[model samples]
Target: MDGKRVLLVEDDSAQSSMLQLELKRRGFRVNAEKTVAAAAARIEKEIFDAVVTDLRLGSGDGLQVVVAVKASQPETGVIVITGHGSIDTAVAAMKAGAFDYLTKPVEPEVLALALRKTIEHRDLVGEVRRLRAEVKERRGVSGIVSASDAMGRVLALVAKVSSTDATVLVTGESGTGKELIARAIHENSPRRDGSFVAINCGALPEGLLESELFGHVKGSFTGADRNKRGLFEEASGGTIFLDEISETTPGLQVKLLRALQEGEIRRVGDNHPVKVSARVVAATNRDLMKQVTAGKFRDDLFYRLKVFPIEIPALRTRVDDVMPLAEAFIKKARVRTGSPATHFSPAAAKALRSYAWPGNVRELEHAVERALIMAGGPTVEARDLPPEIASSAPAKRRVKAKPPRKSRR
Candidate 1:
């Protein structure tokens, strides 16, 4: 483990110093305080990785100290030291979020072991909590579902990074769930209730793209009818997803870099600047670094967008997830179209698994829907699939030559 910030609250000077020295010796940055009040002030001012406290400080109960530390920073671990070791107090401390309780005259080895285990357990629990939060947020939205390990990792990263206002770059091929990950981050973040604006950078022309991202005044162009709010302003206190970011022109890249660095955007035909407060998540199917090397994309903009990068894996890479994703899509389609229960045949599922999904999960979804329509029965069969997928079944298996030919030879 790396050096952790530890707040030690103890009334005994010599014992506190000794414990501080031992913790410092074992890769901990110690902050020794004699009173719970002082410890509370320190915790309010700065974050501590863990807190160690004697059960009875000068005039306060260490249980209060544990409660205070946990309240202020729920992520921080608390270890309570008690001299009158009783089962009741220990149970209370643990219930109150104390990572572990140590009795007075505690052995150095025993304390160290408890501290190590508590820290590890706290880290693991934090990770799980973060992941669950991401999943909850992602599921609350409509038309999105995922259970792949790659998506799980992406959610974990999104949870950790969503608390801060950081620029995130989501890289993946088209239909690989980039925008879904971005939505999850936004929904779990402080801006959960705010608007989420998305625009395709590759779909618009240079001038229109600029005007769309940073709104223009009335009569700014031929079709400009009135002063309109751009996506940046519309997404204030929320998130703006820039899809196909690699398609941005050089001039647009410069403008985007300025907006990210300065948090201000100027509308076309308007001299005044508009201050924008929005988290940015840019997604691109192309290799941005390659684009930068080729002088098509700016290096500065690339670096700015990639501050918190997440890569979404294609369906081909996570083939094991096909069946689960298919079932989820079936449920979704059943609800959406008000159709009766629909499912996949074993042959259809086998076909799905064997085929290399060039279009990723999105392709699998469309194929399943198509099969549902074409099937003679309720279940989707291999024959119900399109030629591309159906033709791959026989080719997926290896054919053994006849042994008679070898014998004749």
Candidate 2:
């Protein structure tokens, strides 16, 4: 057969034989097993592209087969066939790493379609893993530290979009690593070998920002002495990361829209247009939609920048990642300061997770750096944490009390 290798685990002899024959007729190299133990033995000795298993076997539950296949070959797809199918059982199967769940007496065509979809899903996952490994080997993760599912989803989206020349808009709080996301995109994109020019639109005045973005000709202004290349020109054949894009003035927004739409820019004091080839990746902590509604941002520019919108979840929502991020920061801090502090104490970890990180990842990083400096031993204890974090409590809203009424009233 020219199709994939599949292991079919069904307790019933008749059902198992029927499935094996059907799968073989469909071009799959099928191995039929009547028990979970037999399936586990086959998985140990051979690799499969997919596994179709009965949820309840004669000897044991089919979840054991799913676990074994996943443990041995994570790329293998597992589809659970359950006679007693319920939402809870389906959820359990999925949580146990089944690719999909099928109810009892599945139609032959339906089973074939499910197997095809599972194999496709497996291939897609394998491709993502391969791309991630390639990216790590060549360009590192660009210092992006994330272990939470929220960020995992973000990274997956990032990977999928990196191969395209789409304009990306990343929205998050100021210290939530928006620039890091931008860098990761650039590093994994076709423009990896080219320059990645980043400029904060909110960091400069209107006049200077224009000059810096679109370049300036000789004597373009009082301070302009010579012709200078703008960020767009410097980023030709690469990417330009515009941070705090909501801060751009209306006039500058028009220029940005022109560049994004026409792929051309005019230098200051020069009427000649220069063609530039650069991908735009913009970021903002402010709400661009609100800015558009408030007449503070150009609607066209907002649309141009948001071709692919990626919102980063604030660190507070992913508290589970706090300690791992803290540990990573500590490792980097040790390299910078040659400190002996290597880890966080249990109490310190608790304090880190408990605090409301208003400043997000940047705040956590700074806290770790400061704690490393304050720590006198190998580990950072709760006492080493900043008082704001160590003594932090959930924020409470104040309710104003009414003034007491006079008795005469």
Candidate 3:
């Protein structure tokens, strides 16, 4: 604060003189005002790093200074000083946008420290806003990286549903980017700053999954030593993405349904229920409705989770995006693997487009990574692709384009 300017407003002449002298000695430029009107007018015409004012100004209020400072320069910090027993009035000043409050008999050291903290905090908040804006510009719509009409429609739905509090169910074949879609919705939603907890339901047994979702009390079961907060609690204001949701048992489905309906979860071995507000976004590779019909899944839970269903198209179906996605993957994979390849050869493009990619987008990403590692030149050739994709190149692209007849016209 070597050259930082401060505005001091106090009706008491001697107190104002002492405070201004001490602030100047501590390396601040101080401007003294005898009333609230003078301070507010100065704030309107100029900018200061901070303002120090008495809670009770003669025939005027210190809150007027705070209002003036905030209206003109919202980033400026305000500090209010009050008598020893006027904490209530000081708190009211704080509610009016004062940065800090000091009771009477204010020490110069304490005021200096408070000023420094307030300015530092202002700078930190500004930087955070700048960085968040930069990220939003760089990654459009959560960065799904697709350019097909089919995928475009899916992205449109994602954009629409992200603004509301809705339970989403994403369905597609394995490796068709279901989880990616779920994450896109969460990142674009209002709860983006909150926790994004994900887990694969099929990866855990029924008892373990129960404890993991709702938590368990200490000594609830064998090896239970301490109380644990579960994923639902961790995702209190954000999203919880459950993958392979079809794999959950029927009993677990009943509990999940209750949680959805009641906005609460009962921890294992605990009678009390804890409130939770996490948005659920579940993904599955199977026909959930079919499972419900066959009695393998709970019908009530199925309907609850499918409030906003999104079905991702398989990779082979959006053939128009194949080459574009391959190129994008190459940009990332080449940096990771230190590959010399820069682009795909015509033969390589044909192989990528013709093959029925059963494994979908995930498989395409891995294929590009593998090709980049195996390629020897600047171009990725058909032979560099996986055996299944390399041998399935279509016959049409194999033939050269017919050149225009010489002078036929």
What is the RMSD, in Å, between candidate 1 and the native fold over all Cα?
A: 15.8
Query: Could you give candidate 1's per-residue lDDT for residues 113-144 as a string of tens digits?
Result: 77777778778999998997776654544335
Model 3 agreement with the true structure over 96-189: per-residue lDDT tens digits: 8999998889899999999888888888889999998877654446457779999999999999999998999999999988888888888889
Write the candidate numbers in order of decreasing TM-score: 3, 2, 1
Q: Which stretches of candidate 1 lie over 4 Å from their true place?
A: 1-144, 338-341, 394-409
How well does candidate 3 score on lDDT at residue 380? 98
Using TM-score as the yardstick, the better of models 1 and 3 is: 3
Higher-lDDT candidate of 1 and 3? 3
lDDT of 1: 0.83
| Cα RMSD, model 3 | 6.0
Stretches of candidate 2 off by over 4 Å are 1-139, 393-409
Q: Write the per-residue lDDT of candidate 2 for residues 272-376, one digit (tens) a residue.
A: 999999999999999889999999998988888888999999999998788889998999899998889998887788789889899999999999999999999
Which candidate number would show the highest lDDT if scored against the true structure? 3
What are the runs in model 3 whose C-alpha is more than 4 Å off? 2-5, 8-42, 54-63, 81-92, 102-107, 127-140, 159-167, 186-196, 226-239, 250-266, 270-279, 287-308, 320-409
Cα lDDT over the full model 2: 0.89
Q: Order the candidates by lDDT, highest first — what do you get?
A: 3, 2, 1
lDDT of each: 0.83, 0.89, 0.90
